[model samples]
Target: MRALRAGTRTLDLNRRIAVMAIVNRTPDSFYDRGATYALDAAVAAGTAAFDAGADLVDVGGVKFAPGPPVPVEEECARVIPVVEALAPHGLVSVDTFHPEVAVAAMAAGAAVINDTTGLHDPRMADVVAAGNAALVIAHSLAAPRTQHPLPHYDDVVADVLAFLRDRVALATAHGVPEDRIIVDPGHDLNKNTRQTLELTRRLGEFQELDLPLLVALSNKDFIGETLDRERGDRLPGSLAAAAWCVAHGARLVRVHNVRETVDAMRMIEAIEGWREPVYELHNTRPEGND
Candidate 1:
């Protein structure tokens, strides 16, 4: 049985699937586009997600898209307040690849540092270990906000596995415990739609790593392109894909629609017998009390 420990919250991955709600404190988020950019709004949104069944909230101060470079001070300013406010409520994971940002957020009580860099900055492992926080080493071939047009891979899943394996070794060597680390395939990081789709279909391959898998597939471009739908219209596809990941081997799902994702995941879990129905009385009344 595997488990994830994040600050005050610990999740038993062997017993059930977990949800990590998204709280982007940036003005150009692909989904909300800064709707939750304000400090108070970000806190409120995270609080609502926690109430709706999210096991944790991922607070990101910057978008993963290319734009102006946000200074370290500015990034810390944006993330620290939200982390400080939300830490008391539930698990809080700060999504940033910068070692400086990781250092500050952990000091502010973030349980996990969801670094999308896959340890691009080696100092990240040391910084996270110093805080005694779990580290999410997301697989990404490109630097955050950079472009890798028409990226090619002989075998994308195999390539991702190799990358994650190397990063895991690096982290462990830095004194980060094996149990305190997580891995993410980074749905659309640098891959095209076809590659992302292939990755999704075979994400179970990641289970070989033997670490908790956290898949962030909410309203991503791959889903949009595959279904010929826009960002807002991709929930059904996102939910379906999330369900598949959960059924296969994803221990945690990072998502935008917390309330709805929780609903979908619980239903899937119930169907799979990992979760029990809230109540079943449609002819289940001792099989006779109609």
Candidate 2:
């Protein structure tokens, strides 16, 4: 696995999975609504997430829930302030697809751009390249703020892999280095329950891409449906999915419950060390020699 550089900090993938705490700056985000919509609340949430062992905090504007589109200026206004406030403490990732928002957030000291649009916006790549910021090219089949109907895939894993591969290639061709890129499968972005499960089950397939993989499976609707829980009650399922992702070679996990997820990951890491066979051969000889 390649070393993922978020600003001056570099995460060695073989060591452990990086935990990214979600800090929603919008009022209507599916999870953590109103948790940090205001500047003061945003700062407090960021501090708590960092204290809870988050390697990065992803701040987002323009809630992506099914609704009318928010103007680009409003989106920028909502997120840039939070980014600016949290810039000094740790790595901050701006989750926005608009090129203008990307530019503004970077100016506010965000080190990464977590674009759900997969760099579909022509100018988004250029903005990221110009800022020398790390880019997360996430797979999503439809635009934000609209209901994504159930989409079909002949092979869900293969299709997701190909889509992410193509997006990474496009970004690289536009001057973004491979080291500065991360790919996400975009869980629940445009998938049905089965498709989401298949993607999660086969996440290891993306390891062949030779880039760090990020799984955003925090409180998504698919988890809610699978476990028969409301959106707020999906923490256990989310933690389980996160552990599964880590075992399958995921390098980054974007989640809402920072402290709990961090604890779960630590426990998983400890258990992971035990998975290797511990017995060693004492003085042994070939059968014929013996």
Candidate 3:
């Protein structure tokens, strides 16, 4: 797969996993509600994420869990300022399925559109294509504000792979290049605990698509349920899940705790045999001494 370049940083799929920090600019995000709602707070969060070694920052306006919906105009208003604030820093991704928000975010200099609804909105592909930005196609079986009650799959891995393949084809048919697409299984979106766990365990199956896979299991409800902890206490479980995902072929991890995730990624890379390349060899002795 070709590397997707966002400003000075190029995300090589063959290299170690890339970390995408989550910066929710909404007032009701499940994890970080109101943490980054203000423009100044959002900027500070973005800077802190970058300083902590995030390869990208995902900014979201509308919280997509089981909650009341915000109008598209309102969502656009909430996301655009953060996108503008983070533009010059590189690799800012807007997390929304609304076409208007996606367009506005791109206009504000976001490099990627992370649509958790998997392009269910007809105008989404066009907006993303118009901006020539990367798109994260995350699979959710239901609408943006609802959860999938009693979700079932004949074979979760195969179904996810097929769904993502079709979504990629749809985007490509709409003029979005294949290289600019990434796939996510939509970890907690519309999925029950068992389904989410199974998807995480079988993440490697989706690699057959050959596009960059982004696993976003950070601080989600499933982790909390499994670990028997609150949202704030699920950091260790989140890090563990991220490491497992990276080992299983995920190229990018969307995380809430940027610093901890960065440290965990470094540890995973070291265990996976990552080593610095030797670029120079010094010779102290004279050239003809031997």
C-alpha local distance difference test of each model? 0.90, 0.86, 0.85
State TM-scores per candidate. 0.96, 0.91, 0.91
> After TM-score superposition, what is the CA distance of residue 202 in candidate 1 from its true location, in Å?
1.0
In model 2, what is the error at residue 254, expressed in angstroms?
Answer: 0.5
List, residue by residue over 1-290, the lDDT tens digit for candidate 3.
57875433567767667899999888777887687888789889998999899989999988777778898889888888888877887689999988888878877888889999999986899878877679999988888788778888998888888889899989988888777889999897878888899999998888788889999999999999998999889999998898888888888999989998888887777667774533434554577433
Rate residue 224 of model 1 by lDDT. Answer: 92
Q: Using TM-score as the measure, which candidate wins?
A: 1
- Candidate 1: lDDT over CA atoms? 0.90
Best by lDDT: 1
Q: Count of backbone clashes for each model?
A: 0, 0, 0
Clashing residue pairs in candidate 1 (N, C-alpha, C atoms within 3 angstroms): none
Q: What local lDDT score does residue 35 receive in model 2, on the 0 to 100 scale? A: 71
Query: What's the lDDT for residue 95 in model 2?
Result: 92
